[model samples]
Structure formats: structure tokens, C-alpha cells
Target: MKFLAILILLLNILSAQNNIGIDSLQNNTGIKNNLSELRTELDDIFNDPNFSNAFWGVSIQSLKTGETFYKLNPDKLFKPASLIKLFTSSNALLLLGSRYQYRTEFFIDGNISNGILNGNLFIIGSGDPTIMIEDTFEHWLDSLNHKGIFSIKGNIIIDDRNFRQDKYGAGWLAEYMEDWFAPTTGAFCLNKNAIEIKIEPTKIHQSAQISFNTEFIENYEVINHVITSTKNSAVEVKINRIGNNIIDLIGKIPVTTEPYSVYIPVNNASQYFLNSFYEFLLDEGVEITGNAVKLDEYDKNYDFNNTIPLFTHKSEQLTKIVSEINKKSDNLLAEQLLKTIGFEIYGYGSTSNGIKAVKELKQGMGINPNNFIMADGSGLSSYNLLTPKQVVNLLAYMYRSSEFDSFYKSLAIAGYDGTLLDRMKGTKAENNFRGKSSFLENTRGLAGYIKSADGEPLALALIVNNFLVPSQLANYIQDKVCNRLANFTRN
Candidate 1:
């Protein structure tokens, strides 16, 4: 018995030298057989010149049987970038359930008679992040249509007094508001409260046709320097908005495409939406005497207070949003959803509230929330620190939840959609893996559970950090870990 034990120990040491993550799988009776191919694949991967200097880690577990198939340097903490959305969304589902909705309303303070508003009309916003331009306008127009009124006798009002309008997530990039990063709002925002500029090629003008679909504030100056006509078939478009509201276009306009639209960031979402609603009213033959203004305090009493129910603007379900934001790594939607999670659970507003909600949800999930330090709900913060072990441990616990289907489906499938859409293809890992990947300059991480070729389960969390190599090499190491796991066969 001693000699047999010595032989087993020798084999274990040899496997250890291979640096294969088969330590847990080795003793499993359900594993197909003693394996060496996983080690060989890992060796080839680690030895690759592409990953020579990068830091990376992986921890994989099987959902089929709830066993860790393999792991490599999985305990290391690394920036999760957008993977933090997983925690945010999971907490949202668990705390709020799936069917919750955000609403944008149209309220009135005056009487409606003779098809005209006798008082001020208000569009009350409780910070509905999903309120898009077309949708908001449509609701405004529809509200008028509902009243059988095309004109208003009074001013238009935008009540943006749900949360504090000045609140913006701290630690966010300065460029956050310059792009579709979305504005933090207390009242209302449409199409993320941005403007759209469309350029069309002209046949006779010294410049291309410049058009604006959204409210063009005086702060923005449009320079029509684009030159395009019938002869010059190629057209170029460049936006030179150099740190202010001015958008300078200096290029040719394409003739093949119809005038297109894009949502660019606006200065103040609450005010922007407020101004646009009036513009909509003017177009519909509504004339108001008073200027648009925000209420000092939210009106406690309104016409709708006693009115019967009418459908308000609703957002997409949390599950759908989670699938898009997590699997596809959508930055804006994920951030908004995270903020929404905060607003819903904490009885307050802002991303900080969302961060607090995340911590609480982690505790509720039986995870020591202290083990992870997430500064933001979207994982966009470099300060976000997470260990692969903690993530995998969460996955293991979630595997037994009643909402497992909703949670697992939220992950990106390798070789399919989401951030993993283009990865893990043409191998055993193809369509057999689902996970999230996160990276910053010097940090790298991959988390989620994996399934074996024979359909056994594996839960893995891997992170590599403090490396000086390019992140691409870290990603290369990440792919290597996946490749190694794909070769696993159950005994």
C-alpha cells in the first residue's frame, strides 16, 4: 500500500510540473479517465510567444455536475471592466425580480377645453434612462392626440424633480458626457439627451447639406466645410467638436446613403428634454406664453393624481437588458441599468446607491461582499478589484438558485454573441463555454463556469495582474486557458 501511495504521489508531482489545472479533476470518479492532453495544450499555450510576458489566470467549473474542471492562477484579482455588470444585473434580478418597469409621464395642471390646454402641460421625469428621443416625442404627441387637442394655450413645463439633477457618477471619464456615455438626470432625458447631426451631399452648394434632427442649442456652432457634389463620388465625414457645444464638420458627404442620424451628448439632460418638448408642441400648433422652467419642488398634486390610468412609457425588461448589457458588453446600457438597480433597491438615486445595492445583493447571495471591492456598478472603474475565486464561488452558489436559467442565459456564449461572440471557435471550446472577459492596460480577467466535452460541470474564475506586457498577450493567455479546458473528458 505504501509503494502504491508513493507511485500515486509521483504521478501527481509529474502532473504538477506540467502546470495543468487538473488537480481537482484527477481524483474525480466521474472524470472519463486520467488525462494528459489538457496539460499538453496548456503547456503549448503558456509557451506561446504571444503570451510570454502577460499576466493571466483562469478558474473553470462544470455546471453539469458542479465541479471545478480546472483552474490556473484563478485567485488573482483584476479589473473586470464591464463584467461587473453581471453582479449588478444579477442583483437586480434577485432584488427587483424581472418584470419591473420605468415610466415617463405627461401631466397637466390646467383644464382641457375646446381642444386646447387652458394651463401648463408638464412632462414629469423620474429619471427614466430608457426615454429615447423618438419615444419621448411620440409620447408627447400622443398625449396631445389623446386629448384631441393640437394646440396648448399655456406654457410647456418639464418637471425633472425626482432625484437631484446635479448628480453624476464620480470617477467617470471627463469624456463621459461628450459621447453616448449618458448624462445623469433628475428629470428627463431622451435619446440619452443628445443631438443628431446629418450631412448630405449637395449637387450645387459649395458645401454638403447640414441638417439637425435634435434641438440645436446656441452653444453648438455648425461649420459647413464639407464639399461634395455629383462629380466627387467619395465623401468623408469628420466631427470636430473640440471641447464645447460646437460641432465642426470638415469632409465630404456620402451620396449613396440617405441622411443618417446619431445621438450625441447634450449639456444638461433635464433642460434639454424640457426644451425639446416645447419644440414638439410648437410643431403641433401649440402656443405657450410662459418660458420652460424646472419646478423648485416636485408638484404634489397634479391632474393625473385623480385621473384614471393611462399607459406611461415603459422600458425593456431587466432580463432582456441584462442579456444585452452583459453578454454583449454594452457600456452605456449596463451603466444605466446599474444605476437603476441602485435607485430601486436603495430607495435613492445615483450609481453609488447602485454600488451599495450590489454589496447588499452579494451578501444576500451568500457571498462575502467584502471579498470584492467594486467602486462602480458597471465595473468601469480601474479601482474595481475581484478575484476569480470569488466569481467562481458565486457561480457555484447561483447554480442552485431558482433563477439559474435567467442568470446563465445572461452570460456571453463563446463563439457566439456578446463580448465572447468571436472567441473560442473551431475547437472543443466552440459553443461549449459561456463567460465574461475584462481588461485594462495592466490588468486582465475571465470569469464564469465551463462545461466539459463529455458534459460534466466546471466553475472557473481567472485573473492576471501587475504584468508589464500588452493586454493582447494577456488575452492570448486567456484563450489558452479556454483551449486547455475544452480538451477535458469525463471519466
Candidate 2:
């Protein structure tokens, strides 16, 4: 009787195994069918009449199974615009580590006797771009006051040898110089290398009152020709920076218009830093007997390494800095980070060296070198190109990296914050998709990670170029595709 029971149990076990096999086969087939439908739907959307002249490159793959769900010219290269921040931020975080911090130091070349310094004060910059007027300058001045350094008998010197002097990136347009987004970069950067101008109308026919931040008042010359017109008139303002420090504001603002503000990029970032800091010292009652000087202009061969620093200002961690770069899409911060990486890896802070470091990083990440061209740290350059598959591959690789937490948290979540704050709302993809948004004239891109309804994580890259229609139409199509992916399930 015991032998009979054992045989019966074996027969039941065989039946259960057969049932599980059938169910697995059915589930696999269902997944295949759903993927096919997804492809067809995406094809229809890409083929819409509005995008007839546009070049679309898309790649979507499962992060869990490494399966490609869809591809359209996945190997074709397209200008990634600001989406290139994904690569820039990732490379920086991995190589520099999330805990890395930039140090800007102050040194004295001579001895201090009594309450006066007998030598020059040197400020050596390490490319901390987030330094603001009140936050940094005020604190440093207080330190000087507390230390009883009331007078300096020598000049204020700027030691900016940490990075190359090239302020603008390669391939940047000359027209973008006046815009805040195209600010010049340098080791000694101040106020993001730009100044904010606010315009308010005092009367219907009077020149608009133009005001700016006090830190730059002595550094720039403004020619305001704005006229306050009728309440119903359209607001048209044109800001142009002619020559080095002269800003021309020409336009008309309606009486009923709200206060208008614009940020204009500053020329000669190093000089701006020098003049601003010099004035701050004077205002704080610290007398300077000599003029402010740039070390490169005065003595190019000065050795900054031998001097002991008086005080050092350290930047926030790389994690927080990377968050600012990716989330806000800050071009200046991105460029600064690239140069910093170059300095750390190649012993130089030039853009060329930075590009070399980026190339090396891509090789380490197992990405093909021939797949993309990286011309600048920020995607503002038209020369930058990336393939959709390469972007998706990068996303997948980062997902498995130990640095994934910092990198992931830096991305803007759909409908939540950063550039993606207003995107993909009121849908399953809202708050579920974490990605970077890119935009340039006639170009748009979205790249990052999302999860399917079945809880399958996916990495996707969608890029559109040469589109003649309004950019909103392209956004519509991208949003639709994300919604479809979010609602997809194989059960």
C-alpha cells in the first residue's frame, strides 16, 4: 500500500509540471504579441503628417531582459541638444565620485604686520560656478574683518591657472552670446558669468526703469531705450550686448505689462570676478593700496603652488552639483564640470582634454567610440551627435552601476520637477518616467528610463531633427509613446 501511494504522488507531480510549461509558453506568446502591437502603434505615430520632414531616431529596450521592443533608425546619429547632459553628468559622477568638491582658495604673497597685509592677496579659482554675491563674498569679507586685516598694501591678484582661458565652447553661435544660457566659463567665474536686468514701466510714455543686481553695476554699461506704451500694446524687448561690457536694451513695454527681466552674459569673466571682489573689499572698509590685477596679465609664470592659502571656500558635493546640472540643464555648470574632469584625469583643464576623458569613459562603459561625436560638454553645440541606441545603452549601463543612485536622482521626473515639471502629466507615465528633455532650434529629444505596466523597466531614447512644425507637436508624439509604454502589460 505504501509503494502504491508513492507512485500516485509521482504521477501528480508530472501533471503539475506539464501545466506550468503550458502556462509559460502562453505568457511568452502574449508578450511577443503585445510588443508587435506596440511597434505598429509607434510606427503610426512617427509617420504622422506633421513630422513628414522630420528625422526620427528611437530605441526602446527592456532593462530587465535586455530585449529590444522597438527601433527606428536606432543606429542613425542625431543632434541630442541638451540631452547630452546625461552623458556629461554620468561621466563626471563616475570619474569624480559623487563626494567630490571644488576648492577656491585665498592666499597672501607677503607677511601681515599689525592690521595690514604687506603683500598681494591671491585668489586661486577651481571652477566653482555656483558662487553667488551675497553667499560667498559677504562671508569672505566677514572673515577678513574678523581676522583684523583692515588694509592691504599690495594689489589684489587673481590666479586662474587651474583651467584654460577659453570662455566659450567650440561651435557655439555668436548670436547666443547675449543670452544667459551662453555665458562664458572660466576657472574664476562669478555670478554665473551673467547679470540679471529687470525692466519696469513708471509711466505710459517714459523710459522704463532698468535695474540690475548691484554686484555688476560697476562692471557693465547699459543703454536703455525702452518706451512704455499703451496698456494693450504687445511687449517687444530686444537686448543686445555690443563690444565687451556695453548692453543695449531696445524695445517697448506696455504700461500694464508686468516687470520684465532678462539675464545677459558677461564678457571677460575673469575681469568681472576681479572687479566685483575688489569693490566688495572697498565697500566693507578694507582699504586696498593697489589696483586689482590678473596674474596672467601681470606675470604668467607666477607659481601658485608654493604659497600657503589664507582661507578656502569649498563647493557642495558633486552629487548636488550634478543635480543642478541635469535637473536645471545649466550649460555653464555642465561645461565647468567637463573641464574639472579633464583636469582631474588628464592633468589639464582644456576642453580638448575633457573630450578625451569623455571618450575614455565611453570605452570603459563598453560603448562604441564611432557611434557618436562629442564636440562640447553642453549640447548647445550643433556639432554634437548621438545615436539612439547608444543613449539607451548608456541608460542601461548606468542602471547597473554603483553610482546609479546619484545619477538617477539627478534626472528630472515627469510631471514632478526640473525641466520635466510640466510634461507627461495626467497619465500613467506622469511621475513614473524619469528622463532628460532636450531642445534646440528644429530639434527635440527625450531620453531616460520608465517602467511598463507589467513592472518591466525600460530604457528609451527618442530624437527628432529638422522638424518644421511647432515643437509642441513633437512633444505630443513623444508623450503619447511614453503613455503607451507605461500602459503596456503581458499578463
Candidate 3:
């Protein structure tokens, strides 16, 4: 019995030493698997006929052990598309805390006696982009009506002083300026600065019915030329903007099909907000004699200091807003948040200042700022370029920081919600992957965190450019790679 006990102790010591040896090997070499296997797998994926001419960049590292598991052209720059929102969002969380909220204040210059003797309504916006036409505007009107003020003899002045007059992002395509995904950015945005147009088919061979979601239908002249077709027929629809206020809709809709709706960005977002608010006030029984005007149109001598406070509309918390920006890939909200960072940190809200702030933040986070170029916050511009190393570095930094919880939770979970709702469903990566996905004409990217099979956390960034294959193919490759990472275990 004594001999057996001694033998068991010796075996236990040997097992402990073996485990330490394995850990020491991993720590010294940074990974347990042979680098050749990973390289060959990546080469096989990239060397496929579909990506014969594509440029690829990938970087993966274990968060727990700080081991670089794989790297392929990690330093090569590629268009990041919406993946750049990661920078904007993480930086926003670091600079502006998660509890930050945007405030829009209402100030009146004159007195209110017997619901009369009112003055110009000055609305000073702090770049709140979440204001919707349906609920937010109605709430503002209700606030006014609740205050016992129904009439405004003076004008409605919109003070978007928080941001510059530049509404469009730099390098944005002129053709896509009116697209819903590329709506204008401003201190005050309503309905995402877009209008919803619903088209329904009537009887077969009859003209299709057209309708607008907003009461400000007079804002645009619709020239509809649509014909209803038989069931199961191909439905083709096209909307073209001929002039500032003229929109031509030409299409063929099937009678059996449900109503189709499309959202288009307006020409001028500020004016659109004013028009929508004017209509909302009319509906709420509030009378305003003067026209809704921008702050620049008012006299320079108007005293803003004497303005009395009515009510302020506070936007949702920054955490929720950042989730919308990341999960939905909202361009306008990302741009606005970028500018807001600049305005909050510095005194001016401009893209240049915002980019400068982002660079400084990146530098502070130990990332080499010179490796990446951020022309626009939302990555809508083709000029935006980032190396996979830079993205992975950022993700790793965020993963280890105190703000990690907020930043990580804001990302799109695979097969769960956000932009990744329909992707990687029922797979090993379904709940194990959470990241940001990006797509442009010829660019695709995915970057964020993943959990390995042994429950080790990992940060990864994969970017592909100039691929002749469909973007879905790139997504499939990424999903497969993530699955491999999800099943990875240290031997």
C-alpha cells in the first residue's frame, strides 16, 4: 500500500509538469498549433478561383494569452466600410461615457401671457440624430401644448449651431446622396432625414397606388407611372429625382404582391425637419403665423441670452445610440456621433476636427495612427483605408479595457440581432461570434471578438478587397473561418 501511494504521487507530479510544459510552449511560441496549418488553410481559402484576384488581410489573437494564432497580409490596408464604425463607436465610448445623452433645448425670447404674446421659438440642437418624425416630433408638440402655449406669432428658428453647415460626408458619391443609407448628417435630424414611399398594386393592368408616410406630401411632386400586372409577374420599380422637388416613379407591380415601401433621403434635411414639424404643429392645434426658418435667416442682433426655457428633449442614452450605429450600420448616426465627439472635446463640430479627435484617441490607445486613414466617420467614402492589424489591435484594446462590456455588447452577435441577424444561424458561430460586418462595392470586412471552443476569447479582423465574387461568398468564407476559430483548442 505504501509503494502504491508513492507511485500515485509521482504520476501526479509528472502530469503537473507536463501541463506546465504545454503552457510554457504556448507562451513562448504564442500558439499551440503549427503555424503552417493555419497558413495553408488561409492560402487554400484565398487561392480559390473565386478569390484569385482578391486582396486579403486577416489577423487573429487570443485575448486570454495574448497569442497571435494567425496572420495574413495583416498590415495591408483595405477599405473597411462599416467596420470603421468600430473605431467611431469604441472611441465614442472612451471619450464620451456610456451614460452620455444628447439634449435639444427650446428657448423662447418673449413672454407668454394668456397663451399669447409669444416670440420666436429657438431650437438649439446638440447633434441629436435619433429624433423620429412619428414619436419624437409629436412629443415635442405635446410638450408645447401642455405648457399652455398654442400660438407662435413669431418665426420658428432652428439653431443647429452645434455642427457646421456641411451635411454630406466627404468623398460620398453624388449619385448616392439621396439614398436612405447615405442620408444627410446634421445637428438635428428627423426621420433619419428620409421619407417613406409606399407603392401598392391595384387591379391587374391598372395604375399602381402611391402614398407617402408623412403629412408633408406637398414637399415633393410625385409623377407616378406604374402599371399593375398579373400575379407572379416580375415587379420592377424605379424612382428618379428629376429636380429639387420632382420625383418620378416608374414601375410595374404585381396585383398579388404586398405593398412595397422604400425610404429616400431628402434634398435638405434641415428644411425637411422644419416642414415636418410645421405639419405636426398644425395637426396638434398649435398656430404659427411666421414660416419655419433656419437660425441663419434670423437677425444677427437677436438676443439668445434672454430666451426663456420651455422644455428640452433628451435623446436615448449613448449606449442605445451606439448599439443602433453598430448593429444597424447607421451612416447618419455614426457621422453625427463623430462630429459630436469633436464638438464635445473641442469647440467646433466638423469632420476634420472629428477625424483629428479620432486619431488622437487611437494614438492614446497605443495604436499607430499613421497606419490608417479615416476620411469619413461612417466609412462611406472609398478613401477610408485600414489595416487588419490596426482593427484587431483596436478590438484587443477594447476587449481589455474597463469599457469593454459596453463596447462589446454594442456589436452585432452572429445569428442573433443587428446586421448579423440572418448570418451564421444554427452553426457553431451562431452564439460564439460577435463582431462588426462591412460591405462596399468590392470590399468586405468582419472584425470583433469570438469565443474559442475551450472558452478562450479571441479578437479577429478579416478584410477582402477587389474580389470578383459576390459579397455573399466573402461572408461565407468569413463565417467558415469563424467556425474554425470557434472550435479551436490549445493542445
What global local distance difference test value does model 2 have? Answer: 0.84
TM-score per candidate, in order?
0.79, 0.90, 0.90
Of the candidates numbered 1 and 3, which has the greater lDDT value?
3
The numbered model that scores best in lDDT is 2
In order, the Cα lDDT scores of the candidates are 0.64, 0.84, 0.82
lDDT of 1: 0.64
What's the lDDT for residue 325 in model 1?
Answer: 67
Question: Residue 290, candidate 3: how far off, in angstroms?
Answer: 2.3
Worst 10 residues of 2 by lDDT: 20-29
Q: RMSD per prediction, one decimal?
A: 9.6, 13.8, 12.1
Which of the predicted structures, 1 or 3, would earn the higher TM-score when compared with the native?
Answer: 3
TM-score of predicted structure 3: 0.90
Candidate 1, residues 1-491, lDDT tens digits: the string is 98897677566544443432334212233433444556555655556564556555556666675555555666666666666776877777777777767776666666777777666666656566666656667765786777766666766666654544542455565555555544444446566555777776666445777777765453677777877645545556666667666767777655554664444566677777777767766766666676676664344454456433323667777678777766867665666666666667765556677788778767765567777878766665667877666687678767887767878898888778877776655555657777777755566767776666566667776676666644554554665576556556645
**By the TM-score metric, which is better: model 1 or model 2?**
2
